[model samples]
Every structure is written in structure tokens, then in C-alpha cells.
Target: MVGSCSVRFPINLEYLHRTHPHVTTYEPEMFPGLHYRMVVPKVTFAIFKSGKVIITGAKNKMDIDNAFNQVYPILKSSIKITEIL
Candidate 1:
């Protein structure tokens, strides 16, 4: 199954890549989003700088939910806070 969602917040892709090099694959020259692999649920996520997430390889909705739940916190922590006046 493939599912997609948006956190509706900007994500710091570079920071996320720097922090989590093991599970993330980022090649800006080739792709815009980061490819993140999860072990337990066995899903892959295409995480974009715009906070858009595409979940792939999930067998069911439960697995998709699980993957989203697991990744939410990490994405929250990686939010790119900006100043706009």
C-alpha cells in the first residue's frame, strides 16, 4: 500500500539528513525529497522539504498509520522554525 500526508510545516531536510544518516537517503542533485526506511513496519517514506510525506511498501492502513505515528515525532523535532514578520 502507498499512502501520503503532509505535516503542513516546513522540514529541515539538511538537518534531518545530518542527524539521521542511517535510515535516510538524500541526494539533492537527483531528488528533492529524502528517502527514509523504517524497520518494524517495513515502510519507506519520501519526505519532502515542504513536510510532505509519501509512505510506500505498507501492507495495510494499520501499517501506514504505524509508520506515520512513528515518523511524526521525528518530523516534529525536525521542523524548520522560521521568522516572519
Candidate 2:
């Protein structure tokens, strides 16, 4: 299944990729958004600079919600890191 949502602010893909190299993939030449994969909910998030997130591999609404909830803090924390550096 797939789900989509947007955060209130723009996201910095470079900082996200730099900070989460293990789980995030950003190849501007090949794709526009940053691809973030989570293991627990087993979902892939196509996260854009505009804060739009496309979620894939979720089985239901609950999974989607769970995945989003799990990722929100990670994204927020990355912003703090971006501010620091």
C-alpha cells in the first residue's frame, strides 16, 4: 500500500542524507527526492525538499501511521543537526 503526507516546512535533503547515510538515499542526478527506509514498519519514504512524503510498502493505515510517527522525530532531529552544522 501507499500513503502520502506533507510536513509544514521544507526539508534539507543534503543534511538528511549526510546524517542518515545508512538509511537514506539521495541521488539528485537520478532522483529528486530522498529515499528513506525504515526497518520496523518496513516502509520506504520518498521524502522531498518540499516536505512531501510518499510512503510505500505499508500494509494498512495503521502501518502507514506507525511509519510516519516513527519517522517524524528522526526528521525533526535532522533539522536540528542541520542548524548546528
Candidate 3:
């Protein structure tokens, strides 16, 4: 059973938009958050300017945890720490 989880983490959406141009799509007029899809975990999430991430298609805590572990580094490197604060 896979359950989706919503995580509120700080990030710089602008940097992410520029970094992963192909993987992410941002259209503020249509949606508030930027859409991102993870391949290995096969999970989808919405990354907002406010730094709230809504992760979906997670099988369990282990899966979610693993996804986060992998995803966090990407986000961290893409965005500046100060920008998020």
C-alpha cells in the first residue's frame, strides 16, 4: 500500500526551475507549485516557492525516507540556504 506524504521544507524554487529544466515544469498562472517527478522511486511531488513539498506514490516510510534522502541533496545543491530563509 502506497501512501502519499506532504512535507514542508525550505527551498529556492527559482534555482530548481533553472537547474532541472527538463524534469520540472513551472507555470504559476496554472498552478502554484512546481511539479517534479522522481524516477528511481517513481514518486511525484509538487515543490512550492514557500518550500512545501507534497510527495505522492510512496509505498511506505522506508520508501518515503529513501526518496527524501535522495531528493534532499538535489534540492540543497540547487538552492541557496539563505534564499530559503
Candidate 4:
């Protein structure tokens, strides 16, 4: 499966839903953040079901990094930046 990453911050899940209609958004208490997974038929290496997206299971630095990278750009462009460190 292709991995993605993101920081803990505010985001408009609805917008993401619109862009990636097939994506599934979910929150798991085991992980300290939100998660989103989507399936694309064109992605040969995708492990998702034919039309299912799994957006959970980030439990380490690498997993977090992967999700952040995939979502940050979308967040940056679509959301307001109040502060940055």
C-alpha cells in the first residue's frame, strides 16, 4: 500500500471527502491522530479492496511521516495557517 503522513492539526475532512470520494476517513484511539485511506484501481500496488480505503494503523514515526506528507500539501492549500513553528 502507498503510505502518507500529516501533523496533528485542524482540517476540513469534508473537503478531503470531496476530492477523494472513494477515500474512507476514520479515527482510532490507538493512534494519536486522524487517518484516511482510499483505493484507486489504477494503483497497482494498492492493497485496498476493490472499492475500499483503509485510513488507520499509523503507530510509528515512519507511518506518521508517510501520512503527513500525503495530507500536508492539501491542508496547506485548502486551510488557513494560523501559526508555524
lDDT of each: 0.89, 0.89, 0.71, 0.41
Rank candidates, TM-score, best first: 1, 2, 3, 4
Which regions of candidate 4 are displaced past 4 Å? 1-10, 26-35, 38-56, 80-85
Candidate 1 local lDDT, 1-85, one digit each (tens) = 9999889998888877888999999999999999999998999999998989999999999999999999898889875333221
> Residues 2-43, candidate 2, lDDT per residue (tens digit)?
999888677888988988899999999999999999998999
Expressed as tens digits, the lDDT of each residue in 8-62 for candidate 3 is: 4566766777788877888888998888888878777787766677778877777
Per-candidate count of clashing residue pairs (backbone under 3 Å): 0, 0, 0, 8
Q: Sort every candidate by lDDT, greatest first.
A: 1, 2, 3, 4
Task: List ranges where model 3 is wrong by over 4 Å.
Answer: 1-10, 81-85
TM-score of each: 0.92, 0.89, 0.74, 0.42
What TM-score would you give candidate 1 relative to the actual structure?
Answer: 0.92
* Poorly placed runs, candidate 2 (over 4 Å): 81-85
lDDT score at residue 32, model 2, on the 0-100 scale: 100
Error of 4 at 79 (Å): 1.6
Lowest summed lDDT across 10 adjacent residues in model 1 is found at 76-85
Please say which candidate is ahead in lDDT: 1 or 3.
Answer: 1
